[model samples]
Target chain A: MASATELRRTPLTALHEDAGARLVDFAGFAMPVQYEGILEEVGRVRTVGGLFDLCHMGRVRILGERREEAAQFLVHPNISKLKFGAIRYSFFCREDGTTMDDVLVYRDTDEVFFCINAGNRDRDIAWMREVVARYDCELQDLSDDLAMIALQGRASVDALAPLCTGEPPEPVRREGATGPAALKYYSFMRGSVCGHEAMISRTGYTGEDGYELYFAADKAPEIWNALLETGKSAGLTPIGLAARDTLRLEAGMALYGHELDDTTNPVEAGLLPKMVKHTHDFSGRAALEAAIAAGPQRRLVGFTTAGKRVPRQGYTLHLPGDDGGAAIGTVCSGSPSPTLDTIIGTGYVRSELAEAGRTLAMDIRGKRQDVTLVEMPFFKRDY
Target chain B: MSNPTDLKYTASHEWARLEGDIATLGITAHAAESLSDLVYIDLPAVGDSITAGEAFGEIESVKAVSDLKSPVTGEVTQVNSGLEDNLSVINSEPFGGGWMIKVKVSGDLPADLLDAAAYDELAAADAH
Candidate 1:
């Protein structure tokens, strides 16, 4: 862990401090963990909306004429088929089929934007630079120059539409609609936000209808305060990293360092057939194909315990009667889901025991607790 | 919130109220606030023996788990059985309804227990 003095601060750090948020060291950055309370913040996001400071996450732009080819070679998704102004959730994997980092790839008009994890920023940049050296593409680290924010919930569209003053980016606009209302999920547009140039993408990690705005680093405090004021009637409040984690866990979203690591493959993490496009050759294609052929030895699954004890990361899982005998799996992420009012968790179990009805015994603090495997996405919006 | 001057406090954040041979044990408001939104608590059963400076229970919040250290050596005479289902009391009434156990002291209380004023200073330093 980094010391308090050594931690990096975001541009909106003062606003968080002013709000009396409990700040913690996250990914080497001094970020807010919670402002009011975790359960209350989660409830607010589910009912109305919440804003997040995501500027610490890495943003890289790949430019040059061969940008598409470079992205196609480095990521799991086929970049050639992605339309302009669309964002795809993809991963950068190694030759051995293990994941390096999960990324969000946005196809812009002249360049490709990749949003990487905060902890893997430096390593991801080096990896991209090393791979794109042979091609005509050049990598530019835009992490420090841009500030990112997410406005997410069912009321997100209502809160964000009024701030986009300029015309929507040409490719994603509908004929009769304008502003954020015209944009679809996984699509983005370059426009003006409170008189500042910004790129608004209709995407989020909370599994809600939301938009992620990217703008100049210096204009962060202005834009952040503006959104809070404008969206006040809609109940939009500043959300911290703690509620963000519980929200994503309830949504069954994979988090880096928990569900994914350098040694875990995309297949076992449940991102293979749907997230990976095998049409053209990409890194780890052969190994992924072979793993698919052989079937994943272990599978990621979601489970619920009868009690309120949270099944945290690294807890061991075993068969019903094999409590002290041998371990069969390990928990990845777990939390008390305020949306569902239950203790929910995700873990990797042996292939045969990954079914929904199967029961596994989780070793929680030297005691065996029965956890029932359930279909993931513990909570889903009605849409 | 101010610590009760009538009770004794330990550096680990536990508070004890002595009456005759029995001592009522609970965590301080500073401790509960630092833990924040507790979800569960595990307390020792009645008739169990606990030692000073040793953990006799565990408390869990959404993001963290911490030990509840005992302030005096004693045998538990009662346990707050309702606390498992109503963990919020610890956050709302850390010194009152949140009492964890009633122990009959078998030995002298620890010598290092601090008064309310000393605990206030220690907690202030911790908040920084």
Candidate 2:
């Protein structure tokens, strides 16, 4: 294990340490894996609210008249008609029909902002740079310049709405905008929040009504501290990666290194439905088309088992009961849900076994336990 | 409250209190706090023999799963039945209600068994 100095530290590193967080080396950066505790943090986010430091995620800008065209060709989503001041979830794929990195394209006023995963930050930038020669555009890595904070849960808007300066776009209005109106989901506004310039967007991985705020890295402590103080009445606590993983897993959202990888295609990972189905010469378009025509051999499915048994990664999935020996799939992400009181997991299996009612089995270490395939999103908020 | 001076600790963080041939086994509070938010513990069954410095059980929390090594060779005389429903007690009362296994010792304790002061030094070093 490397010492703290050996790993990259975010601007908010001091704040996390001051809060007594359990910091761990994650994706080359020293990040808090849990603060307070996973169960307590997860419960708070599901019921009341929580804030997350997402500075480790990559931030970059693509600028040019043909920026939109160049950006659209790089990812799965067709961003040609993406309105300015909007965001799109996309995947930058390799020419071999494999995933490179999943990204979020922010249609900023002057440039297209790319939010890439920390693990794939450099690779995504280099690949985009390599492909930009085909079009007219310039790519700039802006990771060191910005920091991101995610405010999540049912009560988040009630606490943060007053801080945003500009009137949130219609339908997603705040109490100040009118009353009872929240930032329309997935919409964003450029304004001053907590006395700091911010781009607040109603986007989150927790599957809750929430917002993600982006601001200057140097001002991270001020913004983070302000959110905590302002949100105290709304029950906002600082959550860490452990709860973040469980929250995203329960939402059926795929993580970069887990559900999707270099060897996997979006079609098999339950992302093709969100992809642009039309045939264009996008990278891996032909291979993805070929894979589509041949039919996906495997598809991602969510499952749960009885008792406290959790399905873990690399665990082989088999037919129900102990005698069922052949492997069907492998677990990608799993957690014992704090809200649901059951062990839930998601994995990819033969397309034939993707049905919701079928019973599968997981070889836990050496013991086989019954796992019933269920609908995606193991959790749903009452709010 | 974290490390009782009366108990002896192992480098793996298990604490032992020997009363003649019987030794009560539990993890130190330092170990419990380090594990944090324990979700499950797989303990040895009654009558299972444990070897000193060898793993007798495994404890799991949200972030990791770690082995619980036995400090003294012994036969498991009793096991805590309470952790099945509430494993969080290990973090709350690691020295008291969280006692994991009671054993009947077959041999002497390990020579490297640490007193509370010695274990504190180890934990203190880890803090930095």
Candidate 3:
């Protein structure tokens, strides 16, 4: 019910408007949807370089006497699989197995840095505090004091290499922050970026090769301008949330409200393997186990439309037939893929009909149109 | 976001051109500007009957999808099929190459349509 003006503004809000971006409210914060065009930004991120302002997301630091033990209460049981200085994608779930929110966990020696969805920040913070009360760990919300920017694409490595002036530590290299760019994927290092203290991580939701730079909130505008100027020659373009959705969908990544929600469990969402078998017995483990054992009655899958007409969310998916058509599922997220040059979407289909290559149809304005279940991700990089 | 003086405008942002018994229709430049960066368009087929104030087509930009309503009652005689390949022309040349369809007048055109100045007044009021 809130207007874009009522949403919180990031430190770089002025900069975005100055660049002629179309701003809209997203997750309770005014955010840019695109500077020029979604198609162009999508193409640029896949090929060259792209920048995204992700300042609206919530950032929290967890540290204390029993940080390791407390993590099981804070995140998924898969926290054990994440190495120090690395980032792992996971979900924060309720005891009923419904998702509270999805988040990215960054492991440090004595603490975990958590990046949560912007809209759920207040609720997530309160829940984490209540859940971790028994433990010695403390949860600190850092959202108001930090700004995050993502530099993504194949050329992002070389573009960020110049910022790391010193011989980067091995931990930094492992998390995709090495200056020479030998760091593996999903890694990060805390160091100086353009003379500002920053955490540069090799992680992005766009499914492209990229880095995320987190810095002090006050330094956001200067750092954003600096990155634009420095990376201008490398064909780096400022991307908006519209392009962000298309890029993630093409990569088969999940969005919070669309693919994963309060009623959607990780197993049914097709993320069962990463459930991390009771490693420390985290919350929602029992329900997740039961769901996994019951074999997830509904499954999320990808489909490509036969025509340019995009299948929007809530559109009923039907199985084609000569006599009375039967409803099979519903589209959760759908859009015209700017990169693929056609329509693509994700849907929850009955488990029996979730196989790749299965034929499906979507009721587009009362007319049933043919669609095909395809292998996710809808796209992939060569190397 | 130009509202050409020669064209009559609808409050819904459509523009009408009445030439003899033919009415050429397209979205105004202001409409295209408000719906920045066109992505897809579903143009009405020729021979489809359209009534004034009724939806005749659909247009989608990156962030949202909007309906294109008819400003005059008529039977569609032609559609700008070129939009099937290039929708951005709506942003570049909305009045000319981006015209949506041409219709043969059936009944009387809507009398409530506004000229350029009147339409501009409506636009300004909406802005406030």
Candidate 4:
């Protein structure tokens, strides 16, 4: 028997099993890691479309007299610059400059909706509530009431437009909105999705053109089935968490456990520039300031293998010479890049050796393989 | 999943073929089905010594990576070089063409390994 806390089921649990998905516990939810296989799903999403059930993630709404003011205090100070109907990728930080949770903040006329990681839902809400205890803002935990599904790939809009059935609300011209809009990267508008009033965000964890649909929980099964039915004709495949990891790795997206952890600072993770906003004070400002002045000692960098061997997490990355270079870094995430036809990985390296074109080697099966340092976003496709 | 009666099996899902004193080892059909697709494989050197129940090689599928444990202690005499370019043989013909390594038995093959019928019963019970 499964413990009560062992796993939580989404509304589409039966659907996932019916589709032959291999279910595994992820962030407390019994999520699918693959339907048929990871590679096929990865390639399918890159070429066509993939439907994903993202209902396990948390959602909270901040509204009241001081909503925007309160949300600014909750997120990084740059939250104020996000235009209405646009999403800002940011993190909530602790006083020591460690990330509490990375989130996507969606701005609206009167409220700010925060989409947070599922594993940290309770802690995130409690922390935000305690911090703004004196304020007039209301933090409503809407996670249980809402469901999210992602449709991603070059054929995403092609499969999704029919379900929308109406015009996108108002143009929200914020940074990164046009990129998703031109490619429809992150521009979402409230409209009908499969006959249910829904909010569509052009964002995804997969490195492809995609839209995340947010709707009422009760309607989840219908929407999911509709997507799978409609998407089949457009070559859309139902993907799982396994493909999610590989696709994101190829695109160089940072995952919570592998890339970002409490002990690691975002600055050292190569996200310092995005974390800093000179406009106003926010949480973790002082610690981040100190780290900037002192300079981060270690940094996250990308490396590609010389051959077919995939360097996995915890693989030691060494400098080419100096007797394996004294173990300068450890690989945090890695896999074979199906799109590029090579093995690639992300790891933390000494700041001095993090630059692109630097040569490094990783020990695979007790043998060193040549690798090259490159800038992030290993795969970029035009939507 | 195929459970060939001609092969001797281990609880670790490896099948061993004994010809004289040389035993050729490969994963079983059930193991291949569980692993899904094979992408990358790391084989032990031809002359490396392997102990019974010890990991001799690693194989990676798209989602997971697992080490293949040896069924018998031996000195590796030969390895299936074709598997370097054709790892899918593990999924297609795990009993024959998918044989991984050939070993010269260091001692008697590890005792208590299951026969084909016994392995089928073990696999069926595990499926629950």
Candidate 5:
């Protein structure tokens, strides 16, 4: 582990420090774990609104005429089928069908953008460079040059719509409208936010109405402060990574290191059915097809604990009546849901025992706690 | 906040209020604030023996789990079972209603226990 002095700081580090956030070393970056508290931050996002500094996440742009073909061959999704100004959840997989990293592919007029995890940025870029060598496309690492911010929750549109100026052109415009209001889910528009050029996309990891803005890294503080000041009355607070984890878990989103790893395949993680298009041949398509045909041995399942004790990651899952017996599965992520007021977790369990309403026991520090499998996502917005 | 002058503290952040052979144990305000938003606490039942410098219970916050070390070697005579359901008291009044257990001492209290002034220095050094 790197010491505090050796950790890297984002462009908004000064702002986070001024807000009295608890800074911790996350994935080699000095990031805010919480400002007020985890539960309070989670409440703000679920209720009114919250702001997130996502500059640490990686962004890569694939340029040239062959960008679409190169991207299509790299990820599981068919990038050619993606319409202009649209985004699709995709995965970069190894030859054995295991995930290297799960990314969001955005198709623009001239270039394709890949939003990747911070920890996997270097490896993903290296792999992309090697794979794109066969085509006439070039990969540009835009992580240090651009800053990403996500404004999420119920009042997101009202908070951000006023700050954005001008209109999105045809093909990028949804419903023939302008600004954020004109955009639809998984769509983006090139516009100016707070007088700076930005790519505002209607996308988020949190299960809420939100928008992710990508712009100049130098103007991060100005835009951050502006959004907070404009949305002050609507109870917009700056959230940190701690609440981000709980919020994503409550929404049943797959975290890269936890739910999706090199050893785990998309079929077992439940993304193959919807996110992957098998018509086009992509990397790992053959292995993925074989794995799908053979069926997944263990599957990812969401569970709710009967007690307040959180079934944390790496904790062993057992049969209902067998506490110290052989492990049936292992917990990937767990937390006490501030919205649902119960302990919830995701884990990989045997396919035969992964049905809803089935009871299982989790060994927490030598004691057995009851947990019941349930359908995800645990929470969703009415809108 | 200043450490309570009347109690003795352990390096692990547990505080003990000694009255004759019985001692009341709980975490300090500094410990509780650092652990922030404690959601659950697991304590030993009455009649369970606990050793000084060893974990007698566990406390969990939103993102972390920590061990609660005993400041004295003794058998638990009373357990504050209400903390399991309402752990906010541990955060709001860590030195008051947050008292976790009452132990009847079996041997001498650890000689390494620090006074209020000494514990404040230790906590202050840890803050940096």
Candidate 6:
């Protein structure tokens, strides 16, 4: 109705429409927010398998001899030390000690691939170009050239393994010997799935045992339908962005703008472990070192409300008391988790108040309801 | 999903049915559908006074929370206590067992209340 002149559509847009998905504008792309419902879809991903249209994410390939070096220099993590066919989750940050975006870097035999946020693709690509200019690397935007589907849950492997031709190569196990152990969570293998060459990665955002399949954009519908057909017995359902958000939130994974941003450093985001002990001059390294010396004043924590009230984003949090209660933080991601069967959210609060079991009052609309600070990753899969 | 023809509707998607001196109120089918997967509904206590067009309760779905505004000014005689155990009725049978509250009418019915046809038109327009 707003003149479909601006928003981009993914390759599976027609299929989503046919399946009666409720499409909404996400990062300038018309994407499916939900099909049947968030509760049912997300429940499917947790119990059985659920397929996701991750075509909205950006995929960039870095080529040439110094590709690994170029990719290593941009992020804070030790990407240079990553083994072949391995993926590292790293934060791309500005020089001012704040995050630009959280990205996944893949080390392949020939090229380094980056999975970046769709909304920050243009900015991240520009930043990457600036960083790689110093190294002997050729950068190319492959986002439009690729389509990604994340099949996640306990039932995912049972659904996906039948399509893939061979078993993934054995990963470096935690002993003197080695064998494939559930694909070893952050690694990938190149194999044929549904007769199409796919880079299947164990990396996932939903904190489930799953696989992310990447291939040519044109082959999306074929793979989508094939997976659905093959996975019907495993109860594989087509999931949408709304359920993705809820699943990731329940897993305590941060959304870029909500949990990490240009104004906030990673230390406050409870991601200091991700920052390797580095001497190299990476973007944000110097400012981050300085911030560490001064100590981050706030910390990210998980909070849950009593069953009736849902603490939504931007809700002001305060320490519950009578003496002009002190404001503490703001709710970043909030929703009623179908898995947990209650309201849960994550937010940043003063470092001292970030402990579990602490009581905080979350202002839901005008009422200050009781919210308890608790450990995150609210739902964990046994598998 | 259809709103009962005998019930009076408000612009905010509330439905009220007058039975002698008392009125039973609940959200319409359109409103229930919008609030899919209803998790909680905070109904007003019995004997509480309610004002027309003012929020007397709250309803929550996974996506959002909305205030439940009263359609007619009166005293709340009975709250849907059974709905506390089974909230799915709000989405499944909003016009029947999902009825939220009963109020004793203190005065004449509000003037702007719409019939079924008019309410459906308003719901359609609001969607657009």
TM-score of chain A of each: 0.97, 0.94, 0.95, 0.92, 0.97, 0.94
Give me candidate 1's interface root-mean-square deviation.
1.7
Error of 3 at B91 (Å): 2.2
lDDT by residue (tens digit), candidate 3, A143-229: 989889998888887777776543334654645343637656787777777788887777898888888888899998887777777
Candidate 2 lDDT tens digits, A245-317: 9899888899988899998998888787434555446788878877777779999899988846667778899
Runs of candidate 6 with Cα error greater than 4 angstroms are A1-7, A133-136, A166-182, B18-22, B104-115, B118-128
Q: How many angstroms is residue A100 displaced in model 2 relative to the true structure, after the best TM-score fit? A: 2.0
TM-score of each: 0.95, 0.93, 0.93, 0.91, 0.95, 0.89
Q: Model 3 clash pairs?
A: A175-A187, A175-A188
Better of 3 and 6 by DockQ: 3
lDDT of 6 at A44: 90
What is the lDDT, from 0 to 100, of the residue B63 in candidate 4?
50
| DockQ score for model 4 | 0.40
Q: lDDT for model 1, on a 0 to 1 scale?
A: 0.89
Model 1 misses residue A315 by how many Å?
Answer: 1.0
lDDT of 5 by residue, B1-128 (tens): 77999999999899999999999999999998888888788899999999999999999887888899999999999999998888999888899999999999988888999999999998876651
Best lDDT among the predictions, by candidate number: 5
List-wise, what DockQ does each model earn?
0.59, 0.47, 0.40, 0.40, 0.57, 0.38
Task: Single out the weakest 10-residue window by summed lDDT for candidate 4 chain A.
Answer: A175-184
Candidate 5 TM-score over all chains jointly: 0.95
Tell me the lDDT of model 4 at A60: 91
| Candidate 4 runs further than 4 Å off | A1-6, A173-184, A274-276, B45-47, B115-128
Docking class of 6: acceptable
Q: How displaced is residue B73 in candidate 5, in Å?
A: 0.4
lDDT against the true structure, per candidate, is 0.89, 0.83, 0.82, 0.81, 0.90, 0.83
